[model samples]
Target: MDLNSSSPQTIPVVSTFSSPFDQSPPVKDPNSASTRKPISLWPGMYHSPVTTALWEARSKIFEGLLDPPKDAPPQSELLTKTPSQSRTTILYNFSSDYILREQYRDPWNEVRIGKLLEDLDALAGTISVKHCSDDDSTTRPLLLVTASVDKIVLKKPISVDIDLKIVGAVIWVGRSSIEIQLDVIQPAKEESDDSEPVALTANFIFVARDSKTGKAAPVNRLSPETELEKFLFEEAEGRSNLRKRKRVGDRKEFENGEVNQLEALLAEGRIFCDMPALADRDSILLKDTCLENSLICQPQQRNIHGRIFGGFLMHRAFELAFSTAYTFAGLVPCFLEVDHVDFLRPVDVGDFLRFKSCVLYTELENPDQPLINVEVAAHVTRPEIRSSEVSNTFYFTFTLRPEAKATRNGFKIRKVVPATEEEARRILDRMDADA
Candidate 1:
């Protein structure tokens, strides 16, 4: 499987058929009157499923991001690690010192002043971050606070933006709701005189979305997210989530590769077959007619950094499987899981690779969408001569998802088949119940 000596070519085998892919919508024109038109999403796409899976996996992805156990210890004497050192803490700062001013209300001139003082005391107790602080003062934890959209964004940049003027800001806990806080950090420098050199501080709370249809709008604070705030800013780490790494294998030589050339790689393909009978079949393929030029590869691809990158070959295999599945299903396919990968040989960057997919099973759980099971595989395509070495293989599950009409009940899977009978049999069964 090491691909050091020869060039490579990619072949796309599928047994399926499909209508032309509908193009994505054009970008909105700023000056056009049509700007008010509702934005429409692609009828069927795989991104939603991917997002759902990723969100579910968020905890594992960030497990190493922060120090654990935010709850108070039974006794203060038992503590060893500091609470403020956890990675999840966020910071907040406030500059305005105006007291909860109901002081100037018209009716509050004489007798009304006492009533106003009582009302103000009640308000402060209700709106302050005291709930986030330890009631017994037995435990002291770290605190990161934020209020206002700009503060958090300027501190930590995510992919999108939220309007601070309308919504404010907060620190997000794993799967939990976002919590807002109030806090300050003083400058490191000190003044030469006897006076204190600390700077002034300011903080604000976020406005909640009224309903799904309503955007957030800023308002005077009547309630603050205190309990959740303590968990996020005081109990968590001040750093970002950590990442994982993958290791690679050594490369092999590919001699006199013909199919490995870039000109021969397959683009995509389609065919026709029954919706049932896919699970038992082996070695699935695509209908050649729908495919274009075969993919090509050079010898340099085989010996990648002395060892080939197994991950890249996995991608190549997935591309072929998805393309073939898309043709048969007639819609975008979602990769639900990559159950396992067996790397029998190293794959260089230049080694041409071929791919195939077969339908495992499918059935209608609901009338508007069809659930299908697909299997994918990859192989080395260059250096035509053979030795004891075998082609590498991988396995993945895919759902050829459809855009169900709002009122429709179930989906109808399209007919797509590979050239061979055995391959066709494995990819036709449209059966399996929803989880």
Candidate 2:
């Protein structure tokens, strides 16, 4: 269903309870929070039985967004393609109870950034599927998976019970890749207020795959008619080029002599070039700042593919980064941006995922305005095979809150001292060339 023609007033919100399989309950109060359903998700299209049931249970409300509006004018045709094939937007207003969940409901009834990441991933997936489905004529929709979260900026913390709007649009398209931009919006409290506050903005890249071959599939080419759309298309194109270059460089370094060089350096007990000296370690490096978190992927966190959710993994990494940053700066660190996240492999339900995070680099030219760079690596250990594989790597940047910066005195940014030459090379490779 195309939402380009939908009207806000006539659309009935999600009425089904939060569970995946439960039927819609009778409304006692028309204006209650339970009655104001969140956005509807696509129910039955692909994936396993349990996954389908879960999606169906969670997706009943998303269809309401396609309902026609009662107060707005006709759908504009200037920005996108035809109403049926054009871009779409979904509006969701999750309640505090729904967001806080059972475990997080105790003292702090705040929404977790992990939950927001889950929603962001889902939103981007939905947009990619819809964009690809425009030209698909088969019964099965085109399958697409998230390749990477190129960049994301969380401007402010999202609280529980607030009405948040997620806007998704296709900015650029490649032969099999699509770049999606998502904006997390916080509507103004006062009706008279004209400002629409954006809490977060993200750029996600997805790859289309052939159903039978499981290989890259061609997608529809995007035509940007508007100037803003054209600009985003160019930007996405450039980012895509950079991504390709980095991947090629990494592959070459790993295949060539870089890995061996690092290993040899480690064996020789020599330090890497352009690194801080061992004598300065006491003053620059903090002793207890690094952190590690471990957890088994439960059934609840599994997505339609019976694999652990990417957003859940990202959330775990983010929490680790935040904690490490807080420990280093002795302040309430605010989320600045996610520089990059590469999903190396899918984590299974029973896999033991370990998140190792440390403050990789810090810039403290001005104590009041401190910046931190953290690197979080995810490794999954399979119990059956007694083996572990690298799963994901996340690079994050954060800043301390203004009030904390103002009152702090002894806080300092610590530099990571690589324990080995391989570790040093990893640190060097992790640095963003663009930065």
Candidate 3:
């Protein structure tokens, strides 16, 4: 379905071949006698040199080995850029028998959502870099780090046999933060004028930091032009305010020991589950349904920014979450959405990272499709300092396919019961956030 088409005031419809921003550069013909090999032909080719330079500069500055360029433009010279100025469209022509397509295909012959997540993160970063740049290649670039993913919803399953387009642009910008909106679209067959069906939508939040001082850096302001642009800008503003208010509310709620009606009801349910005679046999303790994996952060997995790649962390977390759901339900679970992801801290190389996942809750309201909510927490542990910090938290929603459910005859997911107050609080927090 065309979500943007539903509203008259929505952003201008994106065309299949034309866009506000520059189109994808033409693919170089391999047969052409060129002294240089195309980056695509190389396995480990880094696509964006501008982004890589910025990341490397940031790392050097952090380590006190280099200083920010003296010729960097002053804040007064930063120009206000419109969303269209940085709007970008990247196409993945998987319909062709290309080598890259094979890497993104899953065992089911569908696009691997995990790999797509990684590409999305990379694309968002690229857009942010474009928005921050003043069209001057000589000046040093600001370090933009992914602060969090506001939301990512998959409206339709993606097929690997079709070409996919990723369109994104800066929707809003704060003094030191930027919000980017991205849409994953599948071009309509026959190339008609109809809007493409959006398979997914994601909003990513990034924070700008100075390469020299490692301090919050100012970014170009966003100037909304069309009615749709203005509306999206306002919507993003509201979401930002809501996030702030929610954070404050959470802190106060924890400090005051407040218990709402929903929390009280859930607490009662926990109490009931504690009683063997009254407990539901179809329920399982949340703690008892956990799966975990550990790995040392390696340099090879780092991003262009020289730290552990956010997408890599997401890929690992997602695999674990998927496995946890599969093991719990005894059926292959289909990913529904990434409710949200929070990057709490930067994970340095060589840090021992542990990914812990568990089934947070389940919804059996729809008999045909049982939904499972899984949460994965990425912790960076330093045994020498006896410190363990949560670097990232991911929430994924999955559901059983109808065919898989039908094959099981009477498959049912057990309700996840919180065994401790902490677990109960975690569930309540998630529920509250969703609400």
Q: Can you tell me which runs of candidate 3 are displaced by over 4 Å?
A: 1-75, 188-195, 254-278
Q: TM-scores for all candidates? A: 0.30, 0.73, 0.81
Model 3 lDDT tens row, 1-435: 332332211222122322222333444436433232222232221333222322332322222112334766544477899999777666665665356567678877778888778767877876787788765434566888899999998887788877777778899999899999999998555554356888999999999987657899899999999999999999999999988897768867864674664465366457556666777778888877899999998766775566877877888898999899999999988998897677899998899999999999888888777889999999999999999999999999999866677787767799887766677778877876776
Cα RMSDs, all models:
27.3, 9.1, 7.7
The top-ranked prediction according to lDDT is 3
Q: Give the local distance difference test score of model 2.
A: 0.62
Tell me which residue pairs clash in candidate 2.
Answer: 6-69, 7-68, 7-69, 20-57, 40-61, 40-62
Tens digits of per-residue lDDT for model 1, 39-59: 112211111111112212231
Model 2, position 296: C-alpha lDDT score: 84
lDDT of all the models against the reference? 0.30, 0.62, 0.74
Between the candidate structures 1 and 2, which one is better when assessed by lDDT? 2
Rank order by lDDT, top first? 3, 2, 1
* Candidate 2 Cα misplacement greater than 4 A, ranges: 1-21, 24-86, 92-111, 134-138, 156-162, 187-192, 250-278, 281-288
Better-scoring candidate (TM-score), 1 or 2? 2
